[model samples]
Target: MLVMLTGAFGNLGMATAEALVRAGHDVRALDLDTKISRARAAELQRTAARAGINLDVRFGDIRDATYVRHAVLACDAVIHHAAILPPTTEHSPELARAINVGGTECVLRALEELRTPGRLIFPSSVSVHGPRLHERPPVTAATPTRGTDEYTRGKIACEEMIRASRVPWVITRVGVSPDPGASSVTLDTLRMLFRISPKNRIEYVHRDDVARAMAAAVTCDQALGKTLMLGGGKGCRITHYDLIQTLFDALGLGRVPFDAFGDESYYTDWMDTDEAQRLLNFQSGRFEDYQAELAARMRPIRLGLRPGRRALRWGFLSLVRPR
Candidate 1:
């Protein structure tokens, strides 16, 4: 199978590309950087050479009509991972709309013109479900999409565009996971409140699981036109308290005061990924296990930043001595 992956050089995009090749599929990776994409393509080619797998990476933005048309027309299926997501989108609303909405429109339009039976897997976000204190667990595909953030709004709008397409498409509304790291208000506020919050349950999935689900959805005809609320299906759910405690423990930060105002709205609502499991053969492990691996990966950086952290702690102590 020939798979076209958008946002190819990104964290998730690269993971997906590598996974697809390892699964024995030829991949064409698309990214915005001409030079970087070419370099990445060479790297992938070299990596594949060592592993007996082959991948082609190209440079292109989904916003360009001509590029979208030319690129999507060549692949057997398309994984639309390209989008202007958070932190950045929160800063540049116009760029967010242009890329998230306009770029998506271009890709869907191309799919319409090509009139090919290509499978499209769009990576939507859980952010579409607006922040609410009464947020419930196991939110399903049938749940309403009411976004509170601009990033979430853009994602919902883009998904709407994808749904309007005549081509077969599967929308996976994904939750926060380690590919992006925890930069949410839930994480920050909880850390500030308690050295940990052991009660607030949160939903998340690893980037690897996300990519696997996306790749699996491509050939799974049953997944077409379906919206899947994906998460770390079984061992995926954890409390912010647990996560914070785990982080502190891993970092050996000692005891710290943690507070929780009992505001569920600060975190993402939980969801059952049964549909994702049934359709995409989803496999998600414990978030703690994912975190351990992340910690392991941070070993080199830990050495690099140890002094800075100590200095910051010292500076904080100096500022707090009843000045």
Candidate 2:
């Protein structure tokens, strides 16, 4: 199979690309012409060579219909992971819509024009369910989508467009994916942690697990035309307070003061992924595995930051008061 993976340099996209190659499929890795993408492309080439796999790296915007059409041609499937996520999406609504919504349209059009339309594996977000009250049930594919943010709204629109199209589609609503390699104990991260309500539930899915899900969905005939909820299973589900404290302890930082944290306003909750797991067989990671990875990465900086941990916490609190 020859697969086109947009945002191939991104955390999820890179994982998916590697997984596809490992599964004996060639990948057309497409992304924007940026410095990061260029650097990652070189790394991807090295990695692919080491694995004895074929990888074609292409650079262009997803919003460009001509580029998208060219990329979509001759591909057996497409795994779309390109999007402007929040915080960034919140600040640039128009750009988010152009990329997330319009970009998807371009892909669908390209696929429609093909004599043999290929399957589309769209990685949507659980955020489309909107902010859930604490007592709400675990979200399923049947949950109503009520996204107030531009990013979530764009995702909803994209999902609808795919469903309405003639193409075979698999929509997987994913949970939070924190890159373990990028995890660090920073002031800004601490501030964000302080703001999250300790009681709110969050599902943390590993990137590799998410990649496996995408790869599985690509070939799984049963997954066609299905909207699945992809999560990390029971071992990855936890409350915000538990997640923070685990990270803090792993990094040699003490537990966060309960009084200092505020109620979370952002959308996040545990998902019912039983059906998805049965169909795709992609759950292979646990939250503890992620914490261990994070701890390993933090070892080098732990000693240097240990002495200033208290100061860092106080500084973060002073910079942003919890709501």
Candidate 3:
């Protein structure tokens, strides 16, 4: 299969592209033209070259219908992973909507208008099931959606559009999947983290795991027109406090007080991923694996900043003001 993947240079995008290539499928990757993206694209090319993977990478924005249509040409499947996530969504709602919702509409229209035979694998977030902290343990595909913010609203809209269209599609409502091997953490991400209560139940998945699932669904007949939940199984399920503690431990910062956490309940919970796991077999990664990767990545930095560890721990308190 020749798969067309949008946002083909982000952490997840690059991972998914590699997974597709490793699976012996040709990849047509599309993403924005930026210095960082260019660098990443070069890296991806090198990786593919070593593995002898067929890769065609193009740089373009998804908001343009013509470009999206042209990008989708001659592809066996489309794995749409492009979106503006939260904190960014909160800061710039219109831009998020334009890219997350409007851009998705462009792709959907292109796929429908062109009468593409292959399926679409869209990566939606579990946050669409709003304020699930007080609800049950595992939310399923049939769970009602209640959008609490711009990002969730956009995801909900895109999912609705895909279902209504005549296109063959798979809507994967993914749990919290962060790249444990990330070089650096963003301030916006930290701010968003600060807004979620530490007590909230979180079913986190690894980026590689999600990418593998997305890659598997590209060719899996069982995934067509199905709404599946992707999570990291038992080992990945934990409280937000546990997650933050692991992260802080990896980064050389001791856990902070519960008072530092947000007052309100957030939309995080363990996802019932039995159907997805049964279909895609993508729940092999565990949180311990993520912690080890993160710790190894930050080892040098942690060593260099060992003297300021106390101050650094206090510095995180700066993310929250008197509230």
Candidate 4:
């Protein structure tokens, strides 16, 4: 299968692309990384090559209908993971709309024109539930969307655009707490809320699980027009404070003071897994186990080694670091 992976240069994008290549699919990556750092480009190239896979990297803004059309025309299936995420969206709503909302319309139009049975896999977020925690109970695909923040609103709007498209579509409403392999808002919030041992509850999933669930949806005829809520494994639940303390203890770092200004929006209400398990045979990992792995990886990095610009430079290199 030829897969067109949008935002392939991003953290989640890279993970998904890597998964596709490993599964022996022809992959092409599209990102607005026209001026991507030399280090990043080289790393991705090397990583792809190491896997005996070479990805065609196309630099184009997704909001541009022409560029999006061209990219879609070149592939058989589409992993539409591109979007403007938080904080930045909070600051600039227009950019978010132009990219997240406008980009979806462009992708859908491209699919319609191309007349391909292209699988449109949209990795949506739990944020669409809005920043507010569910006062009633866990959230399911049928839960009413009430996004209070601009970023979440943009994501919701993007999905709406995709739904209106007359194309094969699978939307995954992802939960918080990324696998150790991906950058996570959950980790950052935990660090901020409970430097010593912050206590809270949240859902999570591994990046690998997310990537596979998406790929499986491509071949699952029953998944079309379905929105599956994906989360970590059954035993994945953990209190926020306990998770924080565990990290602190595991890292052997001194307790750092933290203040809690609860952002209920950060938490994704529990996911309904029945549909996902049945349709995609999806399986996810618990945050605690993933955190343990993260802590282990951090063991080698010298303590108190505050990252500077080199971190960004090195981070770019790490993106495509030899598998």
- Flag regions of model 1 displaced more than 4 Å: 34-39, 50-54, 180-200, 260-264, 300-323
**TM-scores, in order shown?**
0.85, 0.94, 0.94, 0.80
Better structure of 3 and 4 per TM-score: 3
Where is model 3 more than 4 Å wrong at Cα?
A: 181-192, 318-322
Q: Compare candidates 1 and 3 on lDDT and give the better one.
A: 3
Q: Write the per-residue lDDT of candidate 3 for residues 195-261, one digit (tens) a residue.
A: 7788899998989899999999988998898999998987789998888888788878887778787
Off by over 4 Å in 4: 34-41, 44-54, 131-136, 179-200, 250-266, 300-302, 305-323
Tens digit of per-residue lDDT, candidate 2, span 1-323: 88999999998888998888778788899999999899888988888888888899889999999999999889999999998887678789998999999999999999999999899999999889987755575999999998788988999999999999999999999998888787434556567767877887889898899999999888899999999999998888888887777767666778667877788755788999999999999999999888888888888777778889888767755665565
lDDT of 2: 0.87
Q: Residue 169 of candidate 2: its Cα lDDT?
A: 95
In candidate 1, where is summed lDDT lowest over 10 consecutive residues? 255-264
lDDT of 1 by residue, 195-300 (tens): 2224555687888888888888778888888999878875777666566555544444433334322333443657778878988876756787777875776556
What's the number of clashes in each of the models?
A: 9, 1, 0, 7
**What would the TM-score be for candidate 3 when compared with the true structure?**
0.94
Q: Estimate the lDDT of model 4.
A: 0.70
